[model samples]
Target chain A: MLDVRFSDVRLPSGPGVGYKPQHFNDILKNAFPVQWLEIHAENYMGDGGRPLAQLRHLSERFAISVHGVGLSIGGEGRLDPEHLARLKHLVGWLNPASFSEHLAWSTHDSHFYNDLLPLPYTDATLTRVADHIDAVQDAIGRRMLLENPSSYLAFEESTWSETDFLHELTRRTGCGLLLDVNNVFVSAINLGYSPQGYIDDYPLDMVGEIHLGGHDEDTDDHGAPLLIDSHGCEIVDPVWALLDYTLEKSGPKPLLVEWDTDVPDWQTLAAECTRAQAALAKVPA
Target chain B: MTTQSDFEGALLDANKPVPAGLSDGSGRPAGRRYWVYRNNVAVSLGDALGTGFPAISKLVGPQNFKNLAAIFLRQHPPKSPLMMHYGAEFPAFLEGFEPLKHLGYLGDVARIELAMRQSYHAADATAADPTQLQRLGEAELMTCRMTLAPAVHILRSAWPAASIWAFNMVPGSPKPQAKPEDTLITRPEFDPMPHVLPHGAADFLIALAKGATFEDALKVAQSNAADFDLGATLNLALGHGAISDILS
Candidate 1:
């Protein structure tokens, strides 16, 4: 197995906040206690803009981590060559401390959906996912972390459990796990399971980073509990509990507080990072 | 359709049935649960449209804009992963859209928004040193092929696109005048912003953009508007860092 530290990842063992343009000045002027900066890879894909210029300046101060939402590593069709080339170019330029994408697919038949959709985990999918990972790793010349998705539904045809599928994929392709704590909570509540059990079964030894994001709660058609990974609110108590639970076992990985939509002000975001730091402090060294 | 495409097609179009073999993990079909994905796709794409074409969304109001975006998504799913760069066809879609055609200015407004996005994402180039043109004699300067910044965009429209866009963004602004308008977009340093072009500035800029020399561009501008203020236009271009090269 490729050791997480020895892989392309060289992240600092502290909480990082997802970089937003609104907070760029605050982050620089005040010098928040952020250990690194995480940003969506696609947001910086433009040829030139304030976004790219700000990214260049920030990368000089912080360890940049590129999280991709559209690689379609688990798509049924072959990976989009153009998208793959863009990722390669970005990774090559940034040489990010950690680069990662979802285990879920977002593109199908050339139409790129903005959301990450779930896929069935079986022998056939296992081979396809492994091949896609290999291609991504080879193209970027670096190992990437495949994040466990927050799923609202499951496929009956799935033979392998989500944890087992990720374990097998990492084992086959030498990739790493991102291990999103809130996804565990959201998916657990959405599809009936224990978030702890999911984390216990996760391949923690291969995890290079961890993600904690906010989600919205609602009910399904039958009035059962439903949670959507909206990333628009503050981290809830249950998700905070899940993060502490995982940190107790996984020790300290590069934790990121992701608030993509309805992004709060810099102080609020920094406070979220502080809470993550507070949780990280509890983990045994 | 193949199972994957079937699932995708259904997710895109609400009328299509959810693909086979999905479950809610509670001994039921995943149809209702699958609504989460559908909702996510719609909401995220709607948000993308909202940002990419904020003036359009603003002009149509939030609720109507979202409903329109839902229909727009069903017909035109984003072809690229860049959310800001998505909805390239939205302006044209609004033009042909039967329901919105009555608000004919909607298409022109959308066009301006699209132009704003395109200008913002254009390649970064350095502005020409003022001294290069200053060093030239009058005859040499007139024949110089001025290269404009990649971020400079010329938007000519039959509706008052700039005023409509500006009025919506700034509350309590003057109501837009009902007349044809042309605009120039320039990204001097950061965010791309639009400026109202005089009668012939678009012709001047478009000519210069197409490799026209200074004299040639002025000729085109003069033909379009005999009163074209060359001094004012040149000052605007220079102030915005629009000119990148002066090839004599």
Candidate 2:
């Protein structure tokens, strides 16, 4: 197979919402200010369904971004050829403006855990992750944006920081960063670090898309603050503050408001997009 | 460097010790963080199962259901990224699980729910026109093979599986009687409907799905139930748009 490169679109300066099925008819019936729409790549992998049909309709109007959650690009094993082929088929059919996946692994030993599992940032792991990303890019024939993970813990053996690791992946694979701001806040607070410092170390110039989502705050063992990337509720003040802090440096990018669990009505989701748009307006695109 | 398998095995099992050198980058053990990951994986997969089999979850209660779901995830993790297709083997798993032996009917009820999920994601097919069957000659109709919709499925059980599922799922439902029942899943619209498959109608539909001609299916159905109401069964299938084609 030829290793052809497909240039992905740099999303226009605005905000979009993670497309939810509940809001499909509403979106079709009424227009919202959300300039683009993003969907999880795994959800539409089925042969034929309302999801794909809705995506086909939405793609005609919005700048579609295919965000994948099940790629397992950071797993130790090579990327699953079957999953890669499905993704390739989906991307080929959709020709999405932006394609992205997580920097975490969700599969091992042919069984998908269905949750983003964290990884240590060591040289060997970095090499393996880079190779996996390269394979994904080569298979899809399009450059993908890798989103940083929201983790509750870190590894002592991890020699490189998360920012440095992402920087390395970007340099080696020539892929762009998704720069999930909510994940930065969740991980930094959970790991007892400065979200600002992490953002500073991040190669902001390489970020092609941004994500903002809600988080659930709780206390882990030993009474330390722990935040779960639930995406179940409204965006909190701290996460919005982190998004503001990020946009001030990274400027306006293609941002998305993701609320997957306990999804509210279209108006409620669009309200989050409005908030994102208002915030983006502050950052002079 | 630890293998991915080592990390995932620890992540899935809460009792397992974290791999060596796994820390919180603060010179402390990563035990708590590892538990957090473990909880995430178990809870997410549990939630998926709970969503897929709501009636079963309700039958077992939330706490017991959650524990069973956690155990099930460890035993049979998802193979596909599509969560819709996650628990195909769950029915057999329930049947073999010793703890749930007393509730033998639970596995059959789970089968009904699984059939519903499959029907929801099945290929879209146009319902067969009533005229196609009405115009068939007597001999031709008897020899014709009924092509069922991809979203159509029939589940037969010795327990009142369909009634139990409906009682647990819907409000204001009548208490289920301890009688054998069968279910027919048909997705005539966006949502899949699980209808009680009147007596031997399930056997008839099953035979048709297996490519048996109308005559053979009716014979088998009659063998199963001597007084099988062919008119009622025909009305049910035709009314629900379960049949998508017919071949003479």
Candidate 3:
């Protein structure tokens, strides 16, 4: 069998926060409890700027994780060579502790939509996503992590279950998974599945990192609860509970708290990191 | 069409019904839920444009700006995934849009904002040693060519675009007068600032940017305006670290 399993990643099994420039000074002063930082790859792909300068400084002190938002690993077309080259350039220079992208496709034909669109989990999609993951791993010469999408709806054409598809992706491409607990909760509510059941079936052994973020609650046409993965506010109580549930099974992993929109003050975000630290503390590493 | 084609086609067009295969997990049509994807595509791209051209958004009120963004995104969807590079064609779009043609300055103002963004993200370069220019004799200095820093940008406009930008973006600034102006953007530090260039300086910088020798660029500046002040122009460029290299 081809060795589909990856060795342990370099990130420490502690709390990390998505690094925002607004909290740059605060992080420099006292990044206590927060062990690492994750940055969106597309934001720092510029040739030179304050973003790169701050990143260069932060990488010296913290294990930087480059999380890409633009690779479109599930796009039906061939992976964009120019975007792949850009990703390679960034990874080559930053040498981040880990790199990951989503299981969503945001581009179609020549247009790049600024949203992570859902994909049907069929054999064709599985093959396409696996090929793209292989291309990314080959381009960057490192095992990449694929994050699950928070869906507001599902395609009836999907044959494989989401967890099964993710496992098969790891099996074929040797890429690890970024198990976003918040996404799991959101998808559970929207798709009428048990969040715990989803996590139970998840290939936790293949998970390299865990992501927790906030979601906005609404109703579908039938008044069923619909959750939009906004990542704007604090992780709600239930999602945090989901984190505890995940940690109990997976043990300690590099936990990240992501607040992309309406980012809070440094102390506010730091408090979320403190909560993540507490969850990781419960599990024996 | 494939599932993606149908899904993506309906995403940007709110008028289109939900694609065939999607469900809200109840075996019924995904109606309001499908709007989640539709809203995400439009609103996020709208936010990117709003961030990229704040002055444009300010000039066009919030609701109008939102409407304009809806029309713009459908017409000129982003070619690249990077949000920072999203609105390269927006300035031209504003110029050609029939309803906004009355505000002739909007296009130029958009240009200023776009240039500021480019200056912010351009590659880093070290300023040339001022002592090199000081040590050289006048003849040697005139013969040498200079390279502008990667973050330096020159924008010429018929409207006082920089002054208008200042009045809108910076507080307590004087009102812009009705006159033509040229703007120079330079990143001496982390933040890039736009400066209203003196008369004829844009010509001089444009010449230098195109590899003209100092003497040749100086002539171009003087020819454009009889009262072109070389000392002041060089002072602004050197003070802002805009001159990256002096090739002998």
Task: List the candidate numbers ranked by DockQ, top first.
Answer: 3, 1, 2
Residue pairs in clash, model 2 = none
Q: What would the per-residue lDDT of candidate 2 be over residues A1-285, giving only the tens digit for each residue? A: 532334345567798889888887888887467888899998888766466668888988888889999989988887889999999998888888889999899888788989898888999889999999899888888788999999887866678989999999999999999999899999998888999899889999999899999898787666778888999999988878888988999888888999989989888888888888899889976
**Could you arrange the candidates by TM-score from highest to lowest?**
3, 1, 2
Kindly give the stretch of ten consecutive residues in candidate 1 chain B with the minimal lDDT sum: B1-10
DockQ of each: 0.63, 0.54, 0.76
Off by over 4 Å in 2: A1-10, A29-31, A219-223
TM-score of every candidate = 0.95, 0.92, 0.97
> After best superposition, candidate 2 residue B234: deviation in angstroms?
2.4
| lDDT (tens digit, per residue) of candidate 1 on A21-110 | 999889999756688999999988888878888988998888999999998888998999998999888887777888899988888878
Candidate 3, residues B1-248: lDDT per residue as tens digits?
Answer: 24788888888887888888788776887788889988888989999989899999889888888999899999998888888888999999999999998999999999999988988889999988877888889899899999999999999999999999999999998999999999999999778999999999999999999999999999999999998988899889989999999998
Tens-digit lDDT string for candidate 2 (B60-171): 8999988888888988989877788898888999999999999999889999998888787777888888788889999999999988998888888899888899898888
Tens digits of per-residue lDDT, candidate 3, A1-285, equal 543232233989999999999999999999988999999999998889798999999999899899999888889898999999999988888888999999999888968998899999899999899999999999998899999999898888888999999999999999999999999999999999999999999999999899999999889888889899999999999999999999999999999999999999999999999999999889988
Each model's lDDT comes to: 0.87, 0.86, 0.91
Off by over 4 Å in 3: A1-9
